[model samples]
Target: MHTKASVQSVADTARGIVLATVEIAARPEHVFRALTEPDQVVRWWGSDEAYRMTNWEMDIGVGGHWRSEGRNADGTSFRASGKLRRVDRPTALSMSWMSDWDGGQASVVHYALEGTTRTTRLTLCHEELVDRPDACRAYAEGWRLVLGWLQQYLAPQSTEAFFLLRLNPPRPNFSEDMSSEEVALMKLHFGYWATLLQAGTAIAYGPVADPGGTWGVAIVRAAEMDAAWVLTDQDPVIRSGRGFRYEIFAMPQLMRGE
Candidate 1:
C-alpha cells in the first residue's frame, strides 16, 4: 500500500508538460470496463466536487463517436466529443479528445496496458498538442489525479480464491496425472490468469511467494449468492481446473476489509 507521504510527493511533481505512467493493482479488463462503461466512468473521471455525468454516449468501434457532458457541483457544465481512432480489447485504445470550453486544445490520447502478477501497468499518452503547452501540462496533472481516483475506486473488498491447473497434451495412452512439461504448462496458465487481473476480472490476486507461484483473491460484496458464483465461473483457475473444490464460509465484515 502507498503511504500518504508518497501521495503528497506525487502532488508536488505536477509542474509543466509532464508525462506519467501509473501501475494500478487492477486488471486490463477492469480498467477497460471503467473506461467504456458510463456507470463506472461516473465513479472516477473528473476533478473537483464530483462532477455528475449528464449525458454520455459512445459507439466503440473504428470511426465511432464518443461524447459526454459533466455537471459540476455549482451547476457549471463541461462537454467533450471525439472520434474513436482505435479500439483493441483489453490492450490498447486511441481517441481524439476535444472539449466545448475555451482555451482547450485538440489532442489525441492513448491507453496501453501490460500485466503483472497482481497489477497492471497503464501507459497513457496525450500528444499533438505542441501548440497548447498549458493544456498539455494541465492534462498531465489531471491524469495523475484521475488515476488516483481510479485506483481507490476500484479496490475490491472481498476475499478471492485461486485454483491452479495443469493441462496435459492429448495422448491416447496417457494417465490422469500430468508430466513435467505439463507442470510447466500450468505455470504458463498461472501467468496468464495473473494477467487477466489487469482487465478487472480479478478482485485481488497474487502469487504464493514461498514457491514462486501466483495466487490472488477477488472481493465479492456478498457470499452464498449469484454474484460470487458468476465470478468463480469466469475465473480461469476454477473453470479449467476440474479437481479443486469451492466452499463458501462467511467471514465477519471487519475481517473482510469492510
Candidate 2:
C-alpha cells in the first residue's frame, strides 16, 4: 500500500543535496536506540541477501566515537568511523560519517523525530556529502531499504534457520617476525575484507583479538554454501596460484531453510 514512508528528493542544492526525510512509525526513543545501539544496528542495517552487517560499536553521546563495518557476499568489507556531534535524548542526533572509501572526509547526519498517537515520524537529514556522490546515493538508498528491514527485524517472527560454519582445512599463517612481503600481503587481504563489509555481505569476522590465539577466524552466513564457497574457495592465501582445493561440506537444509 506504500503506507510506509517513501524517500523523496526533498532539497538538492547546487553542491550539497538533501535527501528526502524518512518517517518511521516507531517511537522516537526506539528509533534512536536502533540507530545507536550496536546489536540493534546490525540487525536492521543490511540487505536481505548478499549483504549483512557485523562488528558495530556506537557511543550515543556528544563527542563520542562510533564505528561500524558491513560485509558483502563476495567476502569483502568496508569500515566507517565518526564522532557524535549532537544528541538530544530521543528527539535528535547528529554525527560525522567518514569511511575508508573517501579517505576520512566527514559528512554530517542529523536525525529528528515527530510523533502522533500511534505513529512516530523519524526525519533523517544527511548533508555535506563530498567527494563521492555515488556513495551518498548508495547510503540514501540503504536508508530506505533498511527502514523496511527494521520493521521486519522488530517483528515477533523468529529467525527461520541458523547454522554455524566452523573453520576447516588449511591452517592460518602467522610469524612472530613478519617479512615486509608478508605484511603487505596481509594488508591487501584486510583491505579486501573491508571493501566487502561496506557492500554489506560479511556476517562476522575477526583477527583473533585475544592475546593468545593461534589464528583468526570469520563466520559468514549466506543464501547457500555454494555462494559462500565462491567467496572463500579461491584465494591467493589458500590456493598458492594452482587454485582452490577441498570439497565443501554438504548441508542443503541449512541453505534451503527447510
Candidate 3:
C-alpha cells in the first residue's frame, strides 16, 4: 500500500521560509516529470475542484520560463510565472515563482527528489519570502494537498485478483546450513521480494517457521493468476538452478479493518 505523504514545515522567522517534504511511491524521474510536465501539473496543482487551469506552459530548462493561468471557483483569475534557475533531471529543480495576486512579488522554490529505485522523497523549499510569510504558509499547505493528489494519481491500479503463493523446496530441513551458493541465492530472493513489497504488489511475504519444515509464503496482488505466477517464476531462488517452485491459490476476498 502507498503510505501517506509526509509534510514538514520549518519556519525560519529570522529569514522567512518554509520547507515541506513528501514521499511518493513513484520513481524520481516520474515525479520530476509530473512536476514539470504541463499536462500532469494541471491534474494536481490546485486543490479546489472548481479551480480550472486554463493555460499551462513550461520551457523546463535552465534560464527557461514558465507560466500558468487559472480561475478560482468564484471565477477569479490568477496567473503565476516563473524562471527556471536550475533544472537537473530526476533530481532537483530551482525556480523563481511569482503571482499576479502578490503584486509581482516573487519567491524561490526548490524541489529536491531523493529515494530508492521505486520510491521518491520530494522536499520542497520555499525561501526568500521576505514580504509574504502568509503566502509561504499557504503554499506549504497547498503543496501538501498537491503532493497527496500526486501520490494517488501514481498509485497502482486496483488488482483483479489476489493470490497466495506457497514456495516449496526440494529438501524439508533447509536452513542456514545450505550451500554457500544457495545462501547467496536466498539473499537475492529476499531482496527480490522486498522490491515487490516496496512496489505495493505483495501484500505480505516472509518465511514461515513451520515446525514441520520452513517455507516461504507471500500474498500477491495481480490482474491474473499467470501474472502472479510470473513473479514467482522469476524469483532468484527459482532461477538459481535450485529445485524450488511455487503454487498459487486464488483468494476471492480479503477482509480488513473489522
Candidate 4:
C-alpha cells in the first residue's frame, strides 16, 4: 500500500495562475502517458464518485486537439475541449483548455514532470485566468483531487510489510563550515530518499532536528528485512565512507490516515 499523496497548491493572484505540485510513484514517462492517453485520463480525471467519462478523443501533437465528455451523478453532462500548444514527451505539455461549464471561458494549462526512473514530480500550472479567480480556485482543488486519483491508480500493489529505518551518522553537527564535497553528498543523499518517498517504497522520511544530534528517519515498505537493508545500504552518504548506518525494525501494526 502507498502513503497518502501530498498535494501542494500555490495561487498567484497577481499572475492569475494556480500552481499545484505532487509526487507520483512512477516515472515521468508513465505520468506523461497517463496525462495524454485517453483511456488513462478517463480513469482519473473526474472527482465525483458517480462521475464517468463518456467520451475521450485526442490527437497528441503540437497542433493536436483533445476533447472529453462526462456526466455527473445527477445526470448533468459536461464537456471540455483543448488544443495542444506544446508537447514535449514525458517532460512537459501545454494546452489551451475550454469547458462548457464556464460559458466557454478558456485557460492555458501546463504540466511539467521531473524525476528519476522510479518516481516523478508533477507540476501543474493553470494560467490565463485573468478575470476568472473563482475558476482558478476551483481548478486548483479539482486538479488536487484528480492527482490523488491518479496516484492511487498508479500506486504499486504490495503485500509486503513495513519497517522503520533509523539512520545513524558519525556526527550530527551540520554547520556552514562543512566541506563543500560533503555538502554535495548530503544533497545527493536527500535526493535519493526523496525518490524512495515518491516511489512509495518509503512512506515517510525526514531528519529529526534534535538539539543533541540530528538523525534521519524513514518508514520503508519492503517484503522482508533484507529488502529494507538493501535500500538503506544504498544511501550515498553510507557509500561515501561517512560512517552512516541504518537500523531496521519490523512494524507489525502500523496505522496511517489522511
Best model per lDDT = 4
In the range 20-92, model 4's lDDT, one tens digit per residue, is 9998776676678778777567766666675777788989899999998999879899998999999999899
Each candidate structure's TM-score, on Cα atoms with residue i matched to residue i, is 0.56, 0.54, 0.58, 0.59
lDDT of 1 by residue, 1-258 (tens): 332211111121232233557766566766776677665577467656656666777888989999989887788899988989999977888898888763445678788878753466777776776656556666666677766666654443334322222222233222346677556655664675566666654444443332333333433343222233345445554555644323222233424356
lDDT of 3 by residue, 36-122 (tens): 877667765665664666678899779999999998878899998999999999899999999887777878899999977667888
lDDT of 2 by residue, 1-258 (tens): 225555443444444545646555445655666677775677567874756888789877899999988887777888988999999987888888888756777788787777653345767777887555775776666666666565544321222212233332233335355568656655665566566567756545546544443344545445433344445543444444322133223232434333
Clashes of each: 17, 21, 0, 0
Evaluate model 4: give its TM-score.
0.59
Candidate with more favorable, higher lDDT: 1 or 2: 2
Error of 1 at 225 (Å): 16
> Can you tell me which runs of candidate 1 are displaced by over 4 Å?
1-18, 47-50, 102-104, 156-219, 222-258
**Which scores better on TM-score, 2 or 4?**
4
